[model samples]
Target: MKLFFRLAKYLTPYNNYVIGAAISMLIFSLCNIAMIPLIARLSEAIAQKSIFQLNLVVAMAVGIYFLRGAATYGQGYLISFASQRMLFDLRTQLFEHLNKLSFDFFQKWRTGDLISRSTNDIDNIQNGISSTVIQLLPNMLTLLGAICYLFYLNWKLSLLTLMIIPLLSLIINKFGKEMHKVSSDAQKKTSDISSILQEKVAGVQVVKSFAMEKHEIKKFKEESEKSFWLSLKQVQINVTQTPLLAFIQVLGMVAIIWYGGYQVVTGKLNPADLIAFFAGIALIADPVSRLGDTNAIVQRSLASAERIFEIIDLEPTVQDAVNAHDIEIKGEVRFNSVSFKYQEELPLVLEKVDLKANPGEIVALVGRSGAGKTTLVNLIPRFYDATEGEILIDNIPIRDSKLHSLRSQMGIVSQETILFSGTIKENIAYGKIGSSDEEIKQAAIAANAHNFIIELEDGYETVVGERGASLSGGQKQRVAIARALLRNPRILILDEATSALDTESERLVQEAMDKLMQGRTTFVIAHRLSTVQHADKIIVLDRGKIVEQGKHDELLSKSGIYKMLYEMQFKEPA
Candidate 1:
C-alpha cells in the first residue's frame, strides 16, 4: 500500500485526465444500475399486455445503453492518455537519475538487470495504474450502486447476498499474498534470462573462438526453462483463483434466489420486484469477480515497483560538495600521502604515494602489472577518491573543485578505444561538441588520421560500426588521439596508448602523441621500457609503493628496480 501511494505521486501531473476518466466511469456505473429498475418495469409491462407501456420501457433501455457506450469510450480514451504521459515522464526521470549515479554503482549492477528494471518493470507499473486502478473505480461504484438498489427492492434478500462478502475477502487476501511471492521470484528469473542474453551477445566472438556455441546454447536454454516454469506456476495460480471466486459467488446467488422466490409465493413481495432483485444480484457479481482479478494484478505490480525503487532510493557514493566550484586548471598535479582502496575491507591498491608533475613536463610510470601505477594516475582524475590524504591541482585541493571542471581539463587515450555508433566526423567531434568542421580536420591531421579518413568511401561521413569495429586497432587509436588533441587539455594521461600497434602504426601514433604532449602536463604508463627512457622523470613502482624516481640515466646508475626491468625487456635472445 505504501509503495502504491509513492507510485501514485507520478500521476499527479495528469490528474485532470484521471478526473475526466473518473467522471465518465461514474456515469457508466449509474447507467448500469438504472437498467435494473427498468428490468422490473419491463416485466410489469409484459404482464399487463399493453403496447404503449412496452414501447416506453424499450425506448428507455435503448437510451440508457447508448449513454453507457459513450461513457465507456470516454473513460478508455482519457485513461490511456494519462497513463502514456505518465510513462514517458517516469522513464525519463529514471534515465536521468542513472546518469547521476557514481561509477561504483554501475559496478554493483549487471547491465541486463538494470535494463529490465528500466523497461519491463516500468511497463508493469503503468499497466497496474491504467488497467487495474482505472477499472477498479468503475467496478467499485457499480457494485455499490447495485447493492443499494437490491436493498431497496427487498432488504431481507440483500442481507442474504451480503453473507458471502467476508468469505470472499478472506480468499482474496490469502491468494494475493501467494501471488506477490511468486511474482517477485518470476521477475528475478526474467532478469537472469536477460543477463544471459546480454552477456552472450556481447561476447559472441569469445564464444565462437573457444568452440563453445553448443555450451552457450545449453546455458541459455537452462535459464529459459527456469523462466518458463515460473510462468507456468503463475498461470496455475490465476486459473485456480478465478474458478474459486466464481464458485463462491454462485453459492450466494443460489441462496438469494431460493429465499426471494419463497417471499413472492407468500404474498410478501411482488413478482416484478423479485425479478429486479435478481437483476441487481447479477450486476453485483460482475464487479466482485473483476475486483478479485484486480487484486492479483495489484500484487504483481507491487513486486515490479519494489525492484524499480530499489535503484531509485540509492544515494551516489560520489557527488559534488556543498562549496565545490569550477576552476580552470594550469596542470601542476601533486599527490601527498595519497592512499586508496576500492572498498573499506579490501587491501589498499595505492599507499602513501607522493608525487608531483610540473606544467609541460612528461612523467612516466613503470612497473609490473598491479604495481599501483595505473591506480596512482587514476587518483589524479578523481575517478575514485583516495582512502587517505589529499591531491592538489595547481595548489588547490581537487576535492574543492567541481568534478566536471576538474575532468574537462584532462584528456585520456586508453589501449582499448571505445567509439559510439556514428559517423567519423561525429565521433571526432565528440571530444568537443559543436566544434566546426575546420577544427575537426586540423585535429585529425595532427593525429595522422586525416589521410585515411579522406581515402574512405564517404570521407568524413563514413560510419563507424559499434565500438569502431569497422576500423583497425591502430586506426581506432589514431582517431582516439585525434579526439584528445581536439580538446587541447591542460593535462593528459595515456595508458598503454601505443602498446597494441604494429611497428609502422606505432611510429605514426608516437609521432602524433609527441605533438599532443606539447606544453601539457603528461603522465604515461608504459610497459615498453625503451619508450620512456627519455622521460623527464621515471617513477618505478612495486606492490603499491614507489621504489625509485629519477631520469633514465640516474635510475640506471642506482642499479635498482628500473634498471632490472630495463635489462629484462632489452635482454638478448637465449
Candidate 2:
C-alpha cells in the first residue's frame, strides 16, 4: 500500500488524462445501460406488429452504441497515454537511483535481479494499472448498472441474484491471497533465471574454454523448469478462479430463470418486462466474472511493486556530507591510522595503515595477493571509507570534500581493463566529455595507442566490443591509460596495469606509463619487482599490515618480505 501511494504520486502531473478517462468510462457505461430499455421496447414492438416503433428502437440502439464507441476510444487513448508517460518517468528514476548506490549495494544484489526489478517488475505494474485497472472500472460500473436495472424490473428476482455475491466475494478473496503468493514466487524464480543467463552470457568464454556448455545448459534448464512450474501454479489458480466465479453466477442465473419464467407464466409479469430483466441479469454475469481475473492482476502487480521499492528505499552507505565542499587538490595524499574491513564479521583487510605520497612522488606498493594492496589504494578515492581514522588530501579530511570533486582529481587503471562498447575515440574521450578530436588523439599518442588505433580499418572510429573484447590485452590496457590521461588528473593509480602483457607490449605500455606518471602523485601496485625499482619509496605489506618501507634498493638490502618476494620472482628456473 505504501509503494502504491508512492507510485500514484507520479501520476499527479497527468491527472487531467486520468480525469478524462474516468469521465469517458462513466459516459460509456451509461450508454451501455441505455440499451436495456431499447431492447425491452423492441420486444414489445415485435409482439404488437408495430414496424414504426421497431424502427425507432433500432435507431436509438444504434445511436447509443455509436456514443459508447466514441467514449471507449477516449478512455483507451487517455489512459494509455498517461500510463506510458508514468512508466517512462518511473524507469528513469529507478535508473538514476541505481547510479547513486554504493559499491556494497552492487555487491549484495545480483545483476539479474536488479535488471528484473528495473524491467519486468516495472512492466508488470504498467500492465496491471493500465490494462487491468482501466478495464476494471468499466466492468464494475456495468455490473452496478445492470444490478440497478434488474431491481427496477423486478425487486424479488434481483434480491435473489445478489445473494450469491457475498459467497463469490469470499471465494475471490481466498484465491486472490493464494495467487499473490504464487505470483511473488514466480517473479523470484524469473529473477533467478535472469541471473543465470546474465552470469553465463558474460562468462561464455570461460564456459567454452572449460567445455562446460552442456553443464551450463543443464543448470539453465533446471532454473527455467522451476520458473515454469511456479507459473503453472499461478495459471492453475487463474483458471480455477474464473470458472468458480462463473459457476456461482450460473447458480444465480438458474434461480432467476426459474422464478422469472414462473412469474411470466402466472401473468404476474409481462413478457417484455421479464425479457428486459433477463437481459440485465445476463449483462451482469460477464463483468462479474472478469472482476475476479482483474483482482488477480492487481495482486501480481502489488508483488512486483514490493520488489521494486526494496531497492529504491535503500540509503547508500557512502554519500557526500551535507556540508561537504569542493576542494582544489595539489596531489598530496595521506592515510592516517586507517583500518578497513568489508564487513564487521570479517577480518580487517587493512589495519592501522599509515602512508603518504607528496606532490610529484612515485610510491610503489609491493605485496602478495590478498595483502590489501588494492584495498589500501581504494580508500583514497573513497570507494570504501576507512573503518577507523581518516584519510586526508593536503591536511583536510577527504570526508569533508564533495564526492565528484574529490574523485575528479584522481584516475585509476586496473589490471582488468573495462571499456564500454563504443568507438575508440569515444572510449578515449570518455573521461573528458566534449573533448576535441585533437585532444583524444594526443591522449592516445601519449599512451602509445595512436599508432595501432590509426592502423585499424576505421582508425579512431573503430568500434570496440563489450569490455574492449575486440582489442588485444596490450591494446585495451593502453586505451585505458589513454582514458585516464585524458582526464589529466592530479593523482593516478596503476594496479598491475601491465601485468597481462607480453615482453614487447610491456615495454610499450611502460613507456606510456612513464609519460602519464610525470608531474603527478602516482601509486603503483606491481607484481613485477623490476617495474618499481625506481620508486621514490616502496611499501611492502603482508596479511594487511605494512612489514617494510624504504626505497626499492633499501628493501632489497634488508632481505625481508620484499627481498623474499623479489628473489622468488627473479630466481633461476632449473
Candidate 3:
C-alpha cells in the first residue's frame, strides 16, 4: 500500500487529467447504482402488466446506459493519457539520474540488469498503475455504491451478505503476499536472462572462436527454463486466488437468494425490492472478482517499483561539492601522496604516489600489468576519488573544481579505441559538440585521419558501423586521435595508442601523437620501451608504488628498475 502511494505521486503533475478521469468514473458508478431503482420499478411494472410504465422504464434504461458509455470512454481516454505522460517523465528522469552516477556505480552494476530496470521493470510499474487506476478504482467505487443500494433495500440481508467481507479480505491479503514474493523472484530471474543475452551477444566473436556456441545455448536454455517455472508459479498463484475468491462469492450469493426468498414469501419484502436486492448483489460480485485480479497486478507492480527505487534512491559517491566551480586549466598537475582503493575491503591500487608535471612536459609511466599505471592516469581525471591525499591542477585542489571543468581540459586515447555508431564527421566532433565542419576537418588533418576519411565512399558522412567495425584498426585509432585533437585539451593521457598497429600505421599514429603532445602536459602509459625513451621523465611503478623516477637516459644510467625493464624489452633472442 505504501509503495502504491509512492508510485501515485508521479500522477500529481497530471492531476487535471486524473481529476477528469475521477469525475467520469464517479458518474459511471452512480449510473450503476441508479439501475437498481430502475430494476425495482421494472419488476413492479411487469407484475402490474402496465405497458406504459414498462415503455418508460425501457427508455430510461437506454438513456442511462448511453450516459454510462460516455463516462466510460472519458475515463479510459483521460487516464490513459495521464499515465503515458507520467511514464515518459519517469523514464527520462531515470536516464538523467544514471548519467549523474559515478564510475564505480557502473562498475558495480551489470549492463543487462540496468537495462532491465529501465525498460522491463518500468513497464511493469506502468501496468500496475493502469490496472490500479482504471480497473481497481472504478470497481471499488461500483462495489461501494452497490452495497449502499443493497442496504437501502433490506438492512438485515445486507448485513448478512457483509459477513463474507472479512474472509475475502483475509484471502486477498494472503495471496497478495505470495504474489509479491513470486513477482520479485520472477523479476530477478528475468534480469538474469537479460544479463546472459547481453553478455553473450556482446562477446559473440569470442564465443564463436572458442567453439562454445553449444555451451552458451545450453546455458541460455537453463536460465529460460528457470524463468518459465517462475512465471508458471506466478500464474498458478493468480489462477488459484481468482477461483477461490469466486467460490466464496458464489456461496454468499446462494445464502442471499435463499434468505431473500424467505422474506418475500413471508410478506416482509416486496417482489420488486427482492429483485432490486439481487441485482445489487450481482453488481458487487463482478467488482469483487475484478478487484482480486487488480490485487495481483498491484503486487507485481510494487515489486518492480522496489527495484527501480533501489537505483533512484542511491546517492552518487562522487558529485560536485556545494562550492565547486569551473576553472580553466594550464596543464600543471600535482599528485601529493595520493592513494586509492576501489572499495574498503580491496587492497590499494595506488599508494603514496607523489608526482608533478609542469606545463608542456611529457611524463611516461612504464610497468608490468596490474602495476597501477592506468590507475594513476585515471586519478588525474577524477574517475574515482583518491582514498587519501590530494591532487591539484593549476595549483587548485581538483576536488574544489567542477568535474566537467577538470575533465574538459584533458584528452585520453587508449589502446582499445571506442567509437560510437555514427558518421566520421560526427564521431570527430563528439569531442566538442556543435563544432563547425572546418574545425572537424582541421582536427582530422592534425590526427592524420582526414585523408582516409575522404577516401571512403561517402567521405565524412559515411556511417561507421558499431564500434567502428567498418574501419580498420589503424583507421579507428586515427579517428579516436582526431576526436582528442578536436577537444584540444591542455593535458593528455595516451595509453599505448599505437601498440596494436602495424609498423607503417604506428609511424603515422606516432607522428600524430607527437603533434598532440606538443605544449601539453602528457601522461603516457607505455608497453613498448622504445616509445617512451624520449619522455622528459620516466616513472617506474611496481605493486602500486613508484619504485623509480628520472629522465629515461638518467634512469638507464642508474641501472635501476627502469634499466632492468629496458634491458628485458630490448634483449636479443636467446
Candidate 4:
C-alpha cells in the first residue's frame, strides 16, 4: 500500500472489474475454509462409523474440492491479470515521466544504473504486485476464516494459539526492517558494480592502450568484495528469519498439545475436537509461515521500489509550459545574453554572448576544445537550458513552445557519428521514421553515400555492425549526414561532423554538406580552420568570450586569432 500501488484510484476507472475480482477472491477464500469443517466431520465420522458412510463423505469432499479448484482458478486469473496490467501501466508511466526529465538528470546518472532500475528493479516490483499483494490478501482472508471456525470449535484452544500470533508478528516486523536496509545496500552496490563493468568493457581499447587491466581489475575486486559481503549479510538475515519463526512455531504447537491434553484428561474437550483443533493449528501454521516469508519478500520489494520509483517520481526540469501553445517554427534561432554553467557554483562555460543564425545562413563556431562551442549550439535545440537569457526560435522563447514541435525543426550531427545496428536504409530512415525507401536512398545520395551503399552486396539492406564498426570512419560520417539530410529540418547543427575522416572522406562530406546547407540554417563547429574558411559568418571564441564575429576574409584581414589560426592551418604541408 504505497502511493503508487494506490490502484484504488486506477481501479476506480475499472471499478466493476476490480470489484468482481475481489469478490471472487473472497469467495474462494471462504470456500477453502468451508472445506476444513467438512474435513473434520468426515474424519470424526470415520473415527466412529464403518465403511458404509464413507462413500457419501468422500463424494462430497471430491465435489467440494472440484468446486474450490474452479473458484481458485477464477481468483488467480483475475488477480494476476489486474496486477500485470497495473505493472504494465506503471512501466509506461515511468518511461513517460523519464522522457520529460532534463539533461542534467541523465548527466548525473549512469546509463547502466538507469537501465537496471527500469528492468531489474521494476521486475521486483512486478513480483510484489503479482504474488505479494494479490496472493497475500487472499491467504490472509483464508487464514482469518479458518481461525474463526477454530474459535467456534474450541474457544480456549483458539485463545492459546492466538496468544502466540502477536509474538510472530513482532519478530517478522523487526526482521523485515533489517532485511530492507541490507537488501537496499546490496542492490545499490550491485548496480554500481554493473555500471563499472559496462564502462570498462565499452572502452576496452582505452583500457588496453593505457595498460590499466590490473588497475581496473583491482577496482572491480574492491567493489565485488563490498557487494559480496552485503549480499551475504542480506541472505543470512533472510535465511534465519524463517527457521527462527518456525522454531517459535514449534513452541506454539507444544503449548497447544500440552493444554489440549490436560483439557481432554479432565473431559473438558472431546478427542475429535482436540484433533480438529490441531488440524486447525496446522492450517494456521501454513499461512503464518508463508506470511512471514512474504515479509522478507516485501522488504526486498520495497527496496527495489525505491530505485524504480526514483525515476518514476522524478520531476522533469525542462517541461513545456502548461498554458503554452505549439508554434509553427521557421528556424530563425537567436541566443540573447546567454550564460550557462553546468553546476550553479561552477564557473560559467558560456558568458553573456549574443549570437544568431538567420534562416539559411551557414554560421561557423571555431574554438579549442572545452571552449564551450558544443555547449553554445546545444542551447538552440534546448538540450540544456541556459542558466540566464532567452533562446528564441522564430521569435518565441523556447520555454514557451511545445518541446516536440521545437525539436522537430532541428537536426544534429555530432563529431562521433553513431550508427544503429540495422540496415543502411534503416539507419538513414532513423532520421525520419516512416520515410520511404526512395526518400532514404535520395538522402544518402545527397550526402555522397549512395555509391558505396549500392556497392555493398545487399545495397540498402546491408547490415551495419554495432556502432557501425563495419563501416569506415568516412562512411559513417556520410551515413550520419544522410541521417540529418533525411530529417529535412530548417536548422542543422554539425559539431565537427567531418573531424573523424581522412582527406578524401572530408572532401566527400564537404561536398555533401554543400548540398545539405543550400537552403538550411546550419551551425558548424570545427577545430580545423580550413573547414570553416568559407562560412557565411565565422565566430571565434577565446575562453567563454566571443573575440571575433564576421565573414572569413574580414577576420583574416584583422590579423587576430582567426588570422593566426588560418595561417597555421592553411600554411601546413599536405
Candidate 5:
C-alpha cells in the first residue's frame, strides 16, 4: 500500500488532473445511481397515465445519459494526461540517474536487461496508473455509493448487499498476494528470455562458427515454455477472480429480490422503489467485477515499480567529496607509494607503486599482461581511487580535488574505438563540446584522418555506425585520436591505441601521434616495445613493480629484465 503511494508521488505535479478525473467519475457514479428511482417512478407514471406528462421523465433520462457520457470522457482524458506526464518524468529521472552511475555499474549490467526496465517495465506501469488504478477508484466508489443509496431506499436489502461485497475484497487480497509473487517471477523469466534472444541475435556469427544452433534453439524453447506456463497460471487465476466476485454480486441481488418481494407483500415497500433498487445494484455490479479482473494488471505494475526503483535507488560508487577544489594541473603527475585493489581483502593490482610524470614528457609502461600497466595509468586521473597511498596532480592529492575538474585536464584513448552513430564532425566535437568546425578539421588533419574522411562521399558528414563497425580498425583508431587531439588537454593517455593495427596503420598512427605529443605530457601503455622506443623514458613493469626505467638504448644495455625481453624477441625465429 505504501509502495503504491510512493510511486503515485511521481504524478503529484498532475494532481489537478487526477482530482478532476476523480470528481468527474464521482459525478458519473452519482448520476448512474440516481437514475434508479427516477426510472422506477417513470414506470409507475406510464402505467397509471397520471396528470404528469411523459415528456418530462423522458427528457430527464436523456439528460442523465448525456451528462454521464460527458463525465466519463472527462475522467478518461484527465487520467490519461496525468499518467503520460508521470511516465515521462519517471523515464527521464531514471535515465539521468543512470548517467550519474560510475562505469562499474554498466560493466555489470547487460544492455538487454536495462532496455527491458526502461521500455517494457515502464509500459506496464503506464497502463496500471492510467487505467487500472484510476478505474479501481471509480468502481469501488460507485459500489459504496450505490450500496448506501440502496440502504436509504430500504435497509433490509442493503445489509445483504454489504455482507456480499466484503467477500470480494477478502478473496482478492488473499489470492492477490500469491498472484504478485507468481507475476513477479513471470516477469523475471520474460526478461531472461529476452536476454537469451538478444544474445543469440547479437552473436549469430559465433553460434554458426561453433555450430550451436540446435543447442541454442533447445535452450530458448525450454525458457519460453517455462514463461508460457507461468503466464497461463497467472491468467487462469485471474479468470477466477471476477467470476467469484460476480457470484457474490449475484447473492446480493438474490437477497434483495427475496427481501424486497416480502416488503411488497407486507406493504412496507413500493413496487417502483424495488425496481429502482435492482436497476442501481445491477449497474454497480459490472464495474465491480471488471475492477476485480483488473487486479492482474495492478499486480504486474507493482512488480515493475519495484524493478525500476532498484536502479533509481542505487547510490553512486563515485562522487565528488564535499568542499572539493577544482584540480590545478600543470601536467606533473606523481603516484606516491600507491597500492590498489578493485576489492577489499584482495591482493593489490599495483603494490606500493611509485612514479612521476614531469611536464611535457612522455612516460611509457611496457610489460606482459597482468603486469598492471593499464591499471597504473588509470589511477593518474583518478578513474579509480588507490586503496592506499596517494596520487597527486600538481603535488596536490587527487581525493581533495573535484573529480570533474581532475578528469577535465586529461584525455584517454583506449584499444577499443567507440564511435556513436553520428557524423565524423559531431564525433570529433564530442571531445570538447561547442568546438569550432575549423578546429575539428585541424584535429582530423593532425591525426592523419582528414584524407580518409574526404575520401567518403560525405567527408566529415559521414555517419559512423555503432562502435564504428562501418570503419576499418585503422580508421576508427585515427578518428579516436582526432577526438583526443581536439580536446588539447594538459595530459594524454594512449592505452595500447595502436596495438590492433597492421604495420602500415601503426606507422601512420605513430606519425600522427608524434605530431600530437610534441609538447603535452603523455602516458603510453604498449605491448609492442618498438612503438614506444622514442619515448623520453620507458618503465618496464613485472608483477606490479617497476623493474626498469631508462631510454631504449640505455635499458637494453643494462642486461636486466628490459634487456632480456628485447634480446629474446630478436633471437626468436619467425
Candidate 6:
C-alpha cells in the first residue's frame, strides 16, 4: 500500500488529464446506471401497445448508449496519455541514477539483472497503471452506482446482496499475497536467465573452445522450465479466483430473485420495480469480478516497484566534496603514506606507499604479479580513494579537486584496449570530443597508426566490430595509443601496454610510446624488463612496499629486487 502511494506521486504532473478522465467516467457510469432502470420502463410500454410511449423509450435508450460510447473513448484516451507520460519520466530517472552510481556497484550487480529491472520490471508497472487501472476505475464507479440504485428499489434485497462483500475481500487478501510472492520469484528467475544468456553470448568463444554447447543448452532449458512453472502458477491463481468470485456473486443473485419473486406474488411490490432491482444486481456482478482481477495486477506491480526502488535508493560511495573545485596541474604527483584496500574486511593491497614523480619525468614500476604496481599508480586518478593518508597533484591534495577536472589531465592505455562499436575515426575521437578530422589524423600519425588506417578499404570510416573484433590486437593497441595521444594529458599511465603483442607489433608500439612519453609525467607498469630500461627512474615493489628506487642502471648494479627481475627476464636459458 505504501509503495502504491509513492508511485501515485508521478501522476501529479498530469492531474489535468486525470481530471478529464474522471469527468468522462462519471458521465459513463451515470448512463450505465440510468439504462438499467429504463429497461424496466421499456418492457411496460411495449406491453401496453402504446406506440408513442414505446418510441420515446427506444429513442432515449439509443441516445444514452451513444453518449456512453463517446464517454468511454474520451476517458480511455486521456488516462492512457497521462499514464504513458508518467512511464517516460520514471524510466529517465532510473537510467540517470544508474550513471551516478560508482564502479563498485557495477561489479556487485550482474548486467542482466540491472537490465531486467530497467526493462521488464518497469513494464509490469505500466500494465498496472495504464491498462488495469483504466478499466478498473470505470468498473468500480458503475458498481457503486448500481448498489445505490438497488437499495433505493428495495433495501432488504440490497442488504442481502451486500452479504458477499466480506467473503470476496477475504478471498482477494489470501490469494493476493500468494500472487505477490510468486510474481517476485518469477521476476528473479527471469533475471537469472537473462544473466546466463548474456554471459554465454558474450563469452561464446570460451564456450565453443571448451566444447560446452550441450552443457549450456541444458542449463538454459532448466532455467526456462522454472520460469514456465512459476508463470503457470500465477495464471492458475488468476483463472481460479475470477470464477470463484463470480460464483459467490451468483449466490447473491439467486437469493435476490427468489425473495423478490415471493414479495411480488404476495402483493408486496410492483413487477417493474422487482425487474429493475434484478437488473441493478446483475450490473454490479460484472464490475465486482473485474475489480478482483485488478487486485492481482496491483500485487504484481508492487513487487516490481520494490526491486526498482532498491536501485534508486542507493547512494554512491564515491562523490565530489562540496568544496571541491578544478585545479591547474603541472604533472607533479605525490603519494604521502597512502594505503588502500577494496573493502574494509580485506587486507591492504597497497600498504604505507610513498612516491613522487616530478614534471616531465618517466617513473616505471616493475615487480612480481601480486605486488602493488598498478594499484600505486591508480591512486593518482582516485579510482578508489586511499584507505589512509592522502595523495597530491601539483602540491594540492587530489581530494580537494573535482573528479573530472583531475582525470581530464591524465590518460591511460592498458594491455587490453577497449574500443566501442563504431567507425575507426569515431573511436579515436572519443578521447577528445569535438576533435577535427585533421587533429584525429595527427594523433594517429604520432601513434604510428595513420599509415595502416589509410590502407583499409574505408580508411578512418571502417566500423570496428564489438570491442574492435574486426582488427587484430596489435592494431587495437595502436588505436588505443592514438586515442591517448589525442587527449594530450600532462600525465599518462601505461599498464603492460605492449606486453601482449608480437615482436614486430611491440617495436611499432614502443616507438609510439617513446613519442608519447616526451615532456610528460609518465608511470609505466612493465612486465618485460627491457621496456623500462631507459626510464628516468625505476621503482621496484615487493609485497605492496617500495623495495628499490633509482635510475635503471643504478638499481641493476645494486644486486637488489630489480637486478633479480632483470636477470629472470633477459637472461639466456641454460
lDDT of each: 0.89, 0.90, 0.92, 0.83, 0.85, 0.90
- Name the TM-score of candidate 1: 0.95
Q: Is candidate 2 or candidate 4 better by TM-score?
A: 2
Candidate 1, residue 116: the lDDT equals 90
On lDDT, the candidate that comes out on top is: 3
lDDT of 4 by residue, 404-451 (tens): 887887888888889999999999999899999889989999999999
Best by TM-score: 3
- Checking candidate 3 for backbone clashes, the offending pairs are none
How close is every model to the real structure, measured as TM-score? 0.95, 0.96, 0.97, 0.95, 0.94, 0.93
Error of 6 at 197 (Å): 1.0
Writing each residue's lDDT as its tens digit, candidate 1 over 1-574 gives: 7988888888799999989998999999999999999999999999999899899999999999999999999999998888888878878888888987887788888999989989988887877886575788898999999988888888899999999999999998988899899989999988888888888888999999999999999988998888898888888888898999999999998898889889988999999999898889888888899866888888888899999888888877777789999988998999999888989899988889899999988999999999998788878877778899999999999999998998889999988899889988999998999999999999999999999999999998999999998999888988999999999999999898888889999988888889999999999999988888878899999989888999999999998999999999999999
lDDT of 6 at 293: 81
Off by over 4 Å in 4: 1-21, 572-574
Where in model 1 is the C-alpha error above 4 Å? none
Better of 1 and 4 by lDDT: 1
| Residue 160, model 3: Cα distance from true site in angstroms | 1.7
C-alpha RMSD by candidate, in order: 1.9, 1.7, 1.5, 2.1, 2.2, 2.3
lDDT of 2 by residue, 1-574 (tens): 6756877788889999989998999988888788888889999999999999999998998889899999999999998898889888988888998998988899989999999999999999997886464788888888898888878888998899989999999999999899889989999999999999899999998999999999999999999999999999998999998888888888888988999999999999988998888778767777888878888888898899888878888988899999999999898889899999999899999998989889989999989999999999988988888899899999989999999999999999999999999999999998899999999999999999999999999999999999898999999999999999999999999999989899999999999999999999999999998999999989998899998999977888997999999999999998
Ranking by TM-score: 3, 2, 1, 4, 5, 6
| Candidates sorted on lDDT, descending | 3, 2, 6, 1, 5, 4
Candidate 5's displacement at residue 160, Å, is: 0.5
lDDT of 6 by residue, 160-216 (tens): 989999999899899899999999999999999999988999899999999999999
Of candidate 3, the 10-residue stretch with the lowest lDDT total is 1-10
Off by over 4 Å in 6: none
